[model samples]
Structures are given as structure tokens and as C-alpha cells.
Target: MEGLVDINRLASGEAGRALLERVFQDDSERFLRRLRDRVDRVGIDLPAIEVRYQGLSVQVDAFVGSRALPTLWNSATNFLQFD
Candidate 1:
């Protein structure tokens, strides 16, 4: 399924976000490999795959409710367990 799954298309609702999270959690190595190969094939010497992977990981984490920050100041302090 080369080039079949567009990650952008999966950034919609909860289910799509969940699917993206699972994809990264399951086989992130393969995903990065394919991403690098595709980018290299296009003759683009952009950022390292590891760097891109880190950014993607952060994005996925936010979508999956892991890296989200509280909106209110009090809530932020409570969320972080600060005294």
C-alpha cells in the first residue's frame, strides 16, 4: 500500500486520530523508513528522518491526549501537580 495512506487525511476526528496513534505505536520504525525513502526518491535532502519522526511523535502524542496542556492557569497548575 505504497502512497495509499495519506497521514493528513487521518487528522480529522477521534477515530482517525486513534488510527494514526496506533500506526505510530505499532510500527514507527517502518513508517519512518518509508517516509525517508519517499523523500529521498523525490531528490529532497530535507531534515533527518529522526528529526521528522520526533515532530510526528509529538503531534501524535498531542492528538492522543498525552501532551495536551490545560487551558486555565489553575487547571494548569493542578494538571502539573504543582504546589
Candidate 2:
């Protein structure tokens, strides 16, 4: 599945819930509670974010748009170029 990832920033449970609600189309409050329960039961660090359905993991990445992509204008520039 195609997913968008914003640059890292501090997050709170409320924000996490909102994000999940918008992206996953599920009940964020319930999902958050369940996630917390699972983590407490297993005693491990819960993931900051994850997007998957069934068995397939969604691939997400952050990228600047065409203005940031390499073009004829930057073709001569080295090192900083992005394909």
C-alpha cells in the first residue's frame, strides 16, 4: 500500500489517535487502547507508527516533490543530486 510519512516530530497519544483515525479509517481510541494492552502484556516498546493489513507491510517513505528532484538545472551538480 502507498503511504505518506512526515518528518519525525514529537507525538502524544491524542495526536497518534488522530493520525491513526485519518489514515487507517478505524477507531483510534480503541486501537490505541488495544495497542497499549498488547504492549503491557508483552512488556515491549510499541511501534511509533505502522501501516499494514493482513500480512502485507505497507512501504512508506518521505520525499520532496519534483522541485527537489534532479532536473536539467541540477544535472551538473554532484553529491547533492537526487534521482
Candidate 3:
């Protein structure tokens, strides 16, 4: 897999209640290790990405089905929640 699996593709609308699921059903340890490695590469320097906010806005969500992007609950009005 080139990227992480989108769990919302399962479309249950809730998170963290399942003890196990289809995602990571095979080789979860390797999957998680890869995940950690990917995460480690992000945001090492704050100033490097400060301009990212200059042209940003909340998404209008025109897609009707599963999105490839794992959409977070973004707060259009709350800057603190951007994390």
C-alpha cells in the first residue's frame, strides 16, 4: 500500500469502539511502523510551513462518497483546532 487505508471507506461514522477491524488485519505491526515513520517526517520545522496558512480555508465537501483524504473534523472558525 502506497498510503494508509482510509477507514471511513468502511463508513460506520464512529471511531475507536472496535477492538479489531479490516484495516491492519494483516501485518499490523509493519503497518504501524510504517505509519510512525511517515509521521516522523512531518513538521520538523515550524517556520518552513508558516506560509501554509496564508491561502487555506475549510473544505466545502462536494464529494458524495468515500474520500481518499481522511477528512478530520475541521473547525473553520477555530484556529486552535487546526492541529
Candidate 4:
């Protein structure tokens, strides 16, 4: 999708929030890599991205979803819990 998959397009309030949560929810490189791999199958040029954590940032060559982006969360919370 060229733009965001709006929260309203989702089936329900909870599902809509969940979908948004997943879109912004931070995960490991493994997770992002998997998503990128899936996007590669479609063969379109995915959006380039920069995800900043703490004071550090990494430029992702491509990403599968809209760049609606999200507010940074505390890293002290376990990544597993977010997953």
C-alpha cells in the first residue's frame, strides 16, 4: 500500500488498535528481516526507513508498510512482551 492502512479500515476497534500496535511495535532485526523478506516476494520497491532507538538509528533499505510511524517506547520493557 502507498499510504497507511487506516485504523478505520480494520474490522473492529480492538482489532484496529491491535493492527496499529503491531505496525509500530518494536521488534528484533529478525522480525523486520522476515517482514522485508515477505515484501521482497511482491517485487515492488518498498519504502526506505529509519528507525531510531535510544540515540541510535539504522536506515532500513526497504519496509513493507506505511510510514505512519510511532512514538518511541521504553526499551526497558521486554521485547518478548511486545511480541
> For candidate 2, lDDT tens digit of each residue in 1-83?
45855424423467875775576655666799898899899999755887768877778544466544777654455335533
- Clashes in each model (backbone N, CA, C under 3 Å)? 0, 0, 0, 0
Q: Give lDDT tens digits, candidate 4, residues 1-83.
A: 78966566683688787866776665565688888898899887977899867977677543234432342443323343447
Q: Rate the local accuracy (lDDT) of all candidates.
A: 0.69, 0.63, 0.52, 0.62
The ten-residue window of minimal lDDT in model 1 covers 58-67
Residue-level error in angstroms, candidate 4, position 14 = 36
Give the per-residue lDDT digits (tens) of candidate 3, residues 49-68. 44345667786634334433
Lowest summed-lDDT stretch of 10 residues in model 3? 73-82
List RMSD in Å for every model shown. Answer: 15.8, 17.8, 18.4, 19.7
Evaluate residue 55 in candidate 4 and report its C-alpha lDDT on the 0 to 100 scale: 78
Best by lDDT: 1
TM-scores for every predicted model: 0.28, 0.24, 0.21, 0.23
Clashing pairs in 4: none
Encode model 1's per-residue lDDT on 43-68: one tens digit a residue. Answer: 89786555334435333222235334
